[model samples]
Target: MIEIKNLKKVYNDVTVVDIPHLTIAKGESVGLVGNNGAGKTTLFRMILDLIRPESGEIRSNGEVVAGHENWKTYTASYLDEGFLIDYLTPEEYLYFVGGLHQQNRAQVDETLAALGDFFNGEILNRGKYIRDLSKGNQCKVGVASCLLQNPQLLMLDEPFANIDPSTQFRLKNMLKDANKSKGITTIVSSHDLNHITDVCDRILLMEKGVIIKDIATNSSTLSELEDYFGVGQTLGSVPVAGIDEEENH
Candidate 1:
């Protein structure tokens, strides 16, 4: 339940994000795929009100996000390690985040228990501060913290990066479950085409601060996207497996 109208963000002398209008309905799984400097993270920051848009507005659940606090209660995002409390141990940080949502230590532990597969036994009781963990482990911590909040709207930037393949597969399932079973509105921006296609039903292709193509994913979606990005099988690279193969994983 998010809407953007005339949204634009600029830096110095260059426009980075210039979306005119966009909408994401409740329980929708949307993917944003673009190369570097495509303004995906900028758009996400404006949506979260972490940065003010130069023009236009973003509304969550019909309320202007620019000057509102209500949406914060239902929204959870992890853009980078910057979102983590690096000095705190993983357990301490997660518990602290859970407390912010009024969840007790017991509840936080319960949530962590359910995420054991996602964590792959590296997060809890590690005796290591979040800052000491690898980038992929740090990503796991951030994502786990978000899930502990049980958010209604979840946004992740480049979630598939800096993680192992097994963890990536688990993360995709988690997002799918959140959208289909719990009805969470999910938005993720990623560079990996196969992962994004497997996780999101709809895809937004962005370039030079604008949404160039809004595609409803289908059997041929991956190939079509590859063609646009010039990464087609004709380029002497192995073609990624299709959606059916994604499920098999």
Candidate 2:
């Protein structure tokens, strides 16, 4: 379980994020949604200890995340392209990440094999440095490296921002498989509302560093979410909007 209490971050007199309390259980997939500057990235960074929270505490499995060695073993996060080492090739990067988790090269290869065509075969054998790869290819390598260890807690920020449609589909299926098979607790942030609606068990909407709504997908539809986002209006019992019209057709 992940528990956050009174979490806060301030930057240059601006309160970026302030969450009184938040908890995520094991085997749950959560979607963090918001427009730009909503502090979603900030919150993810704090949880991963990449940034220091001004005040508050975050605990994963009863241990404080900031100083806990277990967090390194249990958590795997991909927040930005900078997380990858520019000097390492994709295979070397994957091996390094696995080594940090005490996994062997054979295990790394086996894991990579399971990802199928998502890596385009070149990722494992490409001799060039990560810095030479394209942005989308870099993201693919980063995500592949993160999942190589099968971490219990997975966090990704804007994971689909630059990938192609086919790779995006592959990633969605891969995440679903990981969650179901290993009971991984996953948190994802995306600008694509359809992606969030399709993959997230629950969705949390943030605005200007604050969480405005938390809705469960099991009890809600995309239309309800559109209304909540103020992208459309509710006409009587139905949502009246361009999206609803598109859906009907």
Candidate 3:
């Protein structure tokens, strides 16, 4: 579980994240949906303690995330290719990541083998460094490595982006099964509302550095998200294509 209090991040005097409080429970799959510059990734980075916040604090499983080392033992995240080592082969990167947890070669191999479906046989033994892999495959490598750590808390930003549809589906199923079987706490941010809603039990909508909506999954949740992101809301100058086709002509 994670707890955040009065969290705020600033850049050049502009407030990018201003979360008063937020809590995610253990074994819960929470999705964050927000448009570009919506502060989702900034919040994640702050949680991982990758970016020092201007104010406030975060605690994971009762461990202070800032200025602490214990939380790393239970946390794993894949935000972007920045998380991957481009020079190393996929296998080499995974092995290196697993070794951080003190897992041996056999353990790492077993974990990769178990994720065969998620990897789709394209990642391992390809004689390709991570930088050489396609962007989608690189994303897979990053995600698979996170899962291999057997993390108690998993953080993935845009897990569906760049992935083909079939692999996207498999990734969702893999995440669901992982949460069901191991009680891993998952935090995912995606622009794809459908994928986020499909895998997450709860959803948070962010805009302008604040979580404007916290919704529990239900039949209507998808539609609600659709409408919010759809045209006619006052989200400032974001044009909706085909909203009025006749006028453009």
Per-model tally of clashing residue pairs = 0, 0, 0
Ranking the candidates on TM-score from highest down gives 1, 3, 2
What's the best-to-worst order under lDDT? 1, 3, 2
Model 3 C-alpha lDDT per residue in residues 108-167, reported as the tens digit of each score: 999888888878889999999999999899999999889888899999999899999999
Best of the two (1, 3) by lDDT: 1
How do the residues 1-249 of candidate 1 rate in per-residue lDDT, one tens digit apiece? 888888889999899998777778888899998889999999999999999988999999999999889999999999999999999999999989999999999999899999999999998887999999999999999999889999999999998899999999999999999999999999999999999999998888888888766777777888878887885232222232212233212
Give the Cα lDDT of each candidate.
Answer: 0.88, 0.81, 0.86
Off by over 4 Å in 1: 231-249
Clashing pairs in 3: none
Give lDDT for model 3.
Answer: 0.86
TM-score of each: 0.92, 0.89, 0.91
Cα distance off (Å), candidate 1, residue 166: 0.6
Off by over 4 Å in 3: 232-249
